[model samples]
Target: MSATPSSKLPPFDPRDPLGLDDLLTDEDRAVRDTVRQWTADRVLPHIAQWYEDGELPGIRELARELGALGALGMSLTGYGCAGASAVQYGLACLELEAADSGIRSLVSVQGSLAMYAIRRFGSEEQKQQWLPRMAAGEVIGCFGLTEPDHGSDPAGMRTYAKRDGGGDWVLNGRKMWITNGSVAGVAVVWAQTDDGIRGFVVPTDTPGFTAPEITHKWSLRASVTSELVLDDVRLPAAAVLPEAKGLGGPLGCLSHARYGIVWGSMGAARTCFETALDYARTREQFGRPIGGFQLTQAKLADMAVELHKGILLAHHLGLRMDAGRLRPEQVSFGKLNNVREAIEICRTARTILGANGISLEYPVMRHATNLESVLTYEGTVEMHQLVLGKALTGGLDAFR
Candidate 1:
């Protein structure tokens, strides 16, 4: 006998028109909702003022709250981490970036960059020293890989670490545009060594180590950007991340961070899209709501398609990451497409909201501005394109 068709299906949601919710497990929804509510309660009301003031006041307290929620290092195992799946972490990132890219930058730098570096490459002693505190957000951490003159080309970094007569590592160089740099208790700094590139787990308070906060940023103004100066910073022999040798260590951490951006950028886009949708439905033009116009509908339709498509792409990458089968090239694909698309979505959203879009009263302009920085960081669009090009072309060298 033929089976009868199911009589019920979930009602359509305009916001999530593609019915993407069905793909998430109950646990996923819980994680997403928890983060969403946290951001709604904690970030939404204050973000405008914070963005305007160009500061993230009470950031340490925010970190502690994030830690209490098991979000600081949500995906890593042990050492006080929540050990949730990568997808859960991605969902949390989306929610965080939905509120503000700066907030997500803070978490991404902490968990994906700093903590992951130590967890994946540091010795047991190093892990025992830092991970638990970092995971608990009792100690904030920063990753130092980008230098003033060397961003895409980390191999040419000017930061150098040398062994002194006492066999201690002496670090001297600067890392620029570092997130959480000024507030970080510890910095996982990468520098050139005799052996090759090495990562040092330097305590921020160590003598000769200083992170001076960078001011006057138009993009991601709410985030702390700093220049980490290592003026003959001395460290014990054990300070080096034992397993992290050469460029691969930092690059690996970057891949992980970029994966989060793949999801996080979409979060920013989602917020902008929702804000525009709300405005279009309510704002009247020529005695009719703007939503009634075909032009407005087309804009909304295009935004929805790209937004959901980007979300779907992010989810697919998250699953790949969880399965341990994700490739660097695949990550490049996601970062390249998602960040670019996310920026476009934000821009389109601004157009929908018209003059009000530029106001900090709405999130569209803020997200758009924040995404400009996102577009340049964690491997620029050009770098990702080259990466994908090499992969697709079977190892053709594009960069000379």
Candidate 2:
């Protein structure tokens, strides 16, 4: 049976289906609106070009602009941060990522991983020294946990830090696939120690610290990805983050960033869906708009269902986070479901766009490719599945 196209299509609202917009408080709506407009004005126009060029020029200027908008470290309290609620932070992430995942990646690495580490585990002096500047975007930050040999199994990481005769810490390791690494002023690097895994705040300018840009990437080309090499890098005893011990510290930070991915992935899917919808409404095939075809309509319907549901899940998780009731396993659930579904949505949208979908002019392909990176980062899909499996099995350890 052929589906009949309605004579008049409803106004497109990819991010807000099921009247979810009505549920947002005024502040939440305001936060979403602000980021939406900023992306429309500043990002959407140039993001494709930036992605194609494989670099975002004037990156520092863009960082400052994000700071001025109070986007950097927006959810964290004090230290020149915005102290916005988790929902607002998630909304901002959605808007930014709707423009491009690269943009969202910048904010996530800076705020969720680096800044949050300091705020959650750093001493007052460490926080005072870095958080303010990082929140203001005067100094960019990166988190170093994933290494060349150890990604899924960080416990087996070879990167290690040792105490010198003078009581200073000497770090020796390499971190790979680090976002914002090349541009970072400071790196929150985690390394194995005799006392178990520990995190250290190393200035980029410190002796023996080098961040070499990783090029030729197919995904996240607009973002700065790099390899962090610490060849006997020396840091003061104060540089060690006093509170973060063992794998829990870096895993905690990954949870924070993964939460943002829950929302950001939906944003990317939304862009692809909207773009595909607009194209289907106009492009003709067999003397009718392609959207009039039953097949295309089915694709659109499925994409819409997943996109909206992902947003709803993100909102629920955000509320939990704001209330301090969120759990790591819950975050894992959201990340696994949302990101997996989002990539599916993007791929479906790309099919709806047909051959044009593969082109950067349409944004469908770009978003789809970016989601490839999104799916793997923070926590891989398989890893999250194990987490949920453990949760269901009464804390049974499955990943032996």
Candidate 3:
């Protein structure tokens, strides 16, 4: 008997063993294919080099291209946004992270964090001034919430905004580990105020505002990270985001980004699993393919099972978000499970690749390294665990 292209070996499904594609609408599939093709054409070929160089060259150009594709702020309504469904946005994230987590971070910060802040809470004037250009990619934005001393504990932030006698605002603070910080045209900075924690739209070129690039990071190397310094940067009263106040403001934006990560992590896992499967089929050991052995088969089977399950979880969360019924704890549930499993899948794939897995020639090691950052940011694994713990225990406060 001979093998046919359609029936070759175990029947490749791109790690989607449950036929989940049938659940997606036509528009959803279209969105996924568009992003997948765009990443293949624009990102994958150059990503390894970009990762090695520790910088994303032509980032502004890339932003503009993403805008043209209606990918930036794709799920938002109006202001030149694509106004696509939440599922479409999740699909887009999956495709982007399949290429590189840094690429997905770029989109997530722009659409989910920066643009979402302005859209959800900005005053009409603020939205009229920024969101259109940002959606079009002519203007870039960064979210400033985390500080040099504050990560999970944003309430302890020292960044402060004071009101002058003339009613103008003066902001003084430093925000650390901000993605797209140095390259942004505008920054949505959150500062402690007499009223509470408040968000302000600060132009990046303000006299006392400076975003210096952070150097020598071992993870997310292809993405730009920076420290935002606001040394008495003054702004008009109109710069304030009127609708947002307290810790809930920034936490809301994080919920959006974390939801995207639930899908994006699975994309990285799929890539690693596919790469390993291909290698196992062709790479021989002791005069036979390594995949023929039971141990290798076990590793591959486990990875495939987790990868598909994570994708299903992401899809379910997207549907909830689209229906406006998704909770923050639910997003945490998906993020915690998907990112942890994705990293494990990547590591398992790395072991299957042997020495070659650690090399940049293949993407397994790079995805593994990027997952380390993903596991910590947008709420750490422990943080999510506490979130679920509290939810399950009926208002138990574990972190406190």
Per-residue lDDT of candidate 1, residues 1-400 (tens digit): 9665556666679999999998999999999999999999999989999999999999999999999999987899999999999899999999999999999999999999999999999999999999999988999999999999999999999999999998999999999999999999999999999999999999999999999999999999999999999999999999999998889999999999999999999999999999989999999999999999999999999999999999999899989989999999999999999999999989999998998889988999999999999999999999999999999999998977
Cα distance off (Å), candidate 2, residue 329: 0.8
- TM-score result, candidate 3: 0.97
Predicted structure with the largest TM-score when compared to the true one: 1
List TM-scores for all candidates, in order.
0.98, 0.96, 0.97
Please provide, for model 2 over 41-144, each residue's C-alpha lDDT reduced to its tens digit, 9 standing for 90 to 100: 88888999999999978888889889989999999999999999999999999999999999999999999999999999999999999999999899999999
In candidate 1, position 43 carries an lDDT of 94
* Rank list by TM-score: 1, 3, 2
Per-residue lDDT, model 1, residue 163, is 99
For candidate 2, the TM-score is 0.96
- Weakest ten-residue segment in model 3 by summed lDDT: 7-16
Which ten contiguous residues of candidate 1 have the minimum total lDDT? Answer: 2-11
